[model samples]
Target: MAKKANWKELMTLHLRAYIPALVAFLFLLPSPVFAAALSLSPTNASVRVGSTVTETVFVLSTDQAMNAISGTISFPPELLQVVSVSKAGSVLSLWVQDPTFSNADGTISFSGIVPNPGYTGSHGLTISIQFRGKRAGTAAISFSPSSQVLANDGNGTDILNDTNSATITVTSSASAPSTPPAPSTAEQGLLARIISSTHPDQTQWYNRPHAIFDWTNAQGVSGVRLGYDKDADGEPSVPYSEPLSHKELDLEDGIWYFHVQEKGSGGWGPISSYRVQIDTVPPLPSTVTFPQGTTTPSGSSITALFTTTDELSGIDHYQVAVDGKVFTVTADAGSRPYQVSAGPGAHMLLVQTYDKAGNFSTANGRFFVTGEASSFFDFFSFGWLAVNYISIFLIAFAILVTLLFAAWYIRTHFMAYRYRLNRQLGLTHAHVHKEFDTLKEAITEELLALEQTKSKRSLTREEERLIVRFKKLLDHAEQTIEKEIEDIQR
Candidate 1:
């Protein structure tokens, strides 16, 4: 209209304007694809020569569900040697091919798949790899550009949008370089952030006598020293030379203070400290106090009380045993007294006390239990208790009777023989009897002296010799008298 236009030219202008608008509209539309990412944890690390460093591989499924992944990681073989690869707790449930690594090639490869439901997370751990620092240099742990992460979206489309690599610096010293190189501004910012990984945690209680101190490896660190003491009054004076994470330390029971500091080109950093308690000693030996007398009636129960003291960790529990069999174990603090029922005869009771540190002490006592019996033979049914007492009494009575008869017979026969011997040899019985009386008196005096001395002390050597000599004289006199009797009888 406005100039009745040239129709073809108007149409051309309209087409150009609409084409640009359509293109913009198409660009604004949302795409159906999603992006995923793979990364190595501890993007940077500092390790000492002859020591190992571990790095974990993680995956992020952004907004997509990933079903399968395959990747290769490469490192400089001359500077770092592969130690091991761990796939524990991986998200992938199935393996297309297990993770494999070669030290010669300085490469690691893994291929795995998840179930149909797939997995989506920000920190899906894939694997952890350990490497030994072989030389003093910098090494890069990188993923091959050809690595693939497939989405579960039917088409198996590669959704990997990015990959992250790790950098490690290996030093010659056990901790860090004696002379650290000038650090960048970023490293200077990290100096105050150094911390220990295996610090004695507030909730953890160590039972072993030895411990290992571990710490995070930071950049620009030249050396690390550990100072520890038994108290908290002042700074620790002891020094640990190495910064190795597996450094073994021997510690005893009680409270301890540990301070860790790092040295760099800028001098030593601030000391990081912690207070911890170590308990390794066991409680004192338990004491079992039984009733005054050992005897108890059959089918009756008796109680024994236990007492124990612990200085460091305190008592945790007690265990009781009767006749080599466990009777009961109790954790109640008030349950110190224990009781047991006996059938008959004898029983042995043992009690053990334990500390929180798993150390224990034991004490034991023996007792007898009497049984009821109606008749003499019924006593025999009570086993060793009644039978042993009866046998002992019988043996003692038999010995007494035999001694009485022998005494009578010896007195009569000896007097008759001696009468004949005295008449024939012109000897007097009063002379022999006086000698015997003197010998008996000497023996009695020695025994009295022994009893009067201190209970702990023994008889003197001279006193012992005197008693022996007196006994020999008595024996000789008896032999002389007997010989004369025998000769007279002949």
Candidate 2:
């Protein structure tokens, strides 16, 4: 018993001694720390009032890879005005929302997505903003609380930990020129006019693989040498012998600079470079989903989300067409819901998304609007006119039944009453005529007998008087009977 108690006490002492150590070990273990940082380069800057300074936005990653970033930057509009926002050489593959700035509002918003494998290094350029100092004051530019750095992980976890800002000190000075001066007429006459039908604007992007460049050879120009490649400053190296004024190139999808040098009488003149941007494949198909089911009451609302990315140039705009009424929304406004002014029925939401390169893909979405809360004006809508077939049929059927009931009622009631009245009047007229004829015949016979008796014997005084009175009575009766017969005929 003594040995057993000693062993148990030793075990208890050991347990009490190690419990604190175990807890400390657990606490000392390295915990996962997110180190994604959004910062502005040259945290300090200086410029005179009316002069311009550019500030760059960058994302710094520690060990984890980040795939998306979005933020709104705020500044003092009274002291500084945003000149422009440039996305040149940005590491992000696609712009979720095109960078926009407002000088009056003193804010800039940017959101973009990186392709697979994402960006992992420091100095991942997001955008550069040029600001003009408007007053002599210290201006602070910093990311708003809305800024976020999303990890490349499938779930898009936000790992943004720290955000750094910039400080700018502006002094009073004169404003710079609003724009650069145009080239002189003589300088413009020196270079050949370059034109392309397929890629008309050098700044614009197109999906056409075949790029046709046309130029007019000037006087005294014998030969022209041209180079086409990704290098913006490279000139024609190989000697050219083609005399044609046009050249067509079948190029892969990338930015290419076309450099042309005309061999004038004196020698090769200055090279004029034109940029051509192409993307043959359209943007990948996007699945537009609604949080609410495809069926929604007419009075309710539905939200649609479009998640699409372009490998090269980013999406520019989106179009939604329902019930033949088409409207457009920019990618920045893509988060907005499409207004459905259609009647209750199945509607095909024709969606057309266009990239910056003008490459586009057509997609279809369907939604059914229940007739739960329809307005009276919906009957006059074009969608109602074309699609409200059931309502129209019901109305037509009701009208037809109403017309049939009216015809039956008229035939049974009014027509029968008219026939009965005419019949009753006809019988009464016949009876009156027969009674009048019988009475007249009887009176005529009595008078005729009396007149014969008078002619056969000598007339007494009483007989003559009676005969006169009977004649008068017969005359009055005839007049009254004729009046009664006329009334009956009428």
Candidate 3:
């Protein structure tokens, strides 16, 4: 019985909970309670130059509308102008005017269905138009609901009067495309710039003509080259491309001009002309002067003066040679403008100058070096060298003779004086002469005895024996005396 009661209680709760839901579903089950309609706010508009104009269209229904709709509005090439168009719908349509119609009459239209309509909600459509007044006269344009053209509401109703008007005043045409500023003469000139020569120091001969042309507007030029001169001195114009080269023409020493022209699909561009001067005459060399009576040292430098000139071909170069050896010169070294240092002796210089047109001149001259002043020592030469040796020998001989005399004087005088002094001092009367005389006398006596004995004992045997013995004794004594004499002499 308790389980049956619980089941009955649960069924009652469920049934009560679903009763209100069922009633609400049945009440809101219809499509909508209203029909859609179209209307315009203000229904008309006005505007002036530099002012804005707007047109608005609205859609309504007796009850409510559910479907969404969208469409575009286009205008003629010349009529009212449309700046911007806006609409509120599920899908809004956008329109643009052709650039050719930028100044023409134009209009904008909008059509789209209402979106996300609730069970009891009413739906409406709105369109807003924006445009700029561009002229000084009256301009009119219109807009309307496109959906109502063929279709009618289910209850036989029509809501198509939602179209609106916009009035605008444009008081002037001065802002038209033809009112741009006109170009001046200079501005109308060629769109190119003048370019200076690339290298200022360069020059060329007319026979071997070479030139630099301003390529400021390379895009504007087609082909460029030198024109011919029939009247030799007249200005040359730009002609068709020619097979002749500057080498074939004589362009030396004169004023000249070149023509540059261009061509393109638009048309030919203006011809641009540039002027250049050609000079070929060489300058006169300077006068060369060497200082008189000058001589250079082995590695010293000397200077020479000279002259130079250039009327046509400006001075180009110069050189100085000493015995065919070229003296390397600094950039500014010259005779006319300046002078160059030459080696000792004579030098030949050739001054060569050239102009822009390749004209040149050559001049040659010589210069000398001055001899240096002399000192007394400078008078000496190899010739005097022999005298040096002679004087040396003479001095040596004199020294030798003096030494011999000095030795003899010292030996004789000093030795004799020392002997005398020794005698006076009683050291010893060294009778050297006496000693020598004694020695001589003794030798003479020995010789005499030997001779007498040899003569007296020639035939007797005992007497010969005695004489021999005596002679032996005498020889011994003579030997002793001779030794003593030799010691004293030394």
* lDDT by residue for model 2 (233-306), tens: 46777567654477899998766778787776566676777889887767666677776678887766656766
Per-residue alpha-carbon lDDT of candidate 3 for residues 155-237, written as tens digits (9 for 90 to 100): 42333334344444444436464233654444334333434352223234342344454445444344433453312123335
- List TM-scores for all candidates, in order: 0.36, 0.41, 0.27
Listed per candidate, the RMSD to the true structure in angstroms reads 32.0, 20.8, 39.1
Q: What lDDT does each candidate get?
A: 0.73, 0.79, 0.47
Sort all candidates by lDDT, best to worst. 2, 1, 3
Leading candidate by TM-score: 2
Per-residue lDDT tens digits for candidate 1, residues 1-490, read 7555788788999999999999999999998768889999899987667656778999999699999999999999999987657666799779897787888999999999989889998999998887778999899999999899999989999999899999998888744444456666644543433233443563344467666665664566656666667423235344444443334567765545566666666766555555555666666676667754567787677767676656555567887777667754665642555667776787788778887667888888787888764766565566668778999999999999999999999999999987887675555555666777787788778766766773658878986776678678767877888687667656
**Two-way TM-score contest, 1 vs 2, winner:** 2
Candidate 2 wrongly placed segments (more than 4 Å): 1-190, 200-205, 222-246, 250-257, 270-337, 341-347, 355-358, 371-490
Candidate 3, after superposition: displacement of residue 262 in Å? 3.3
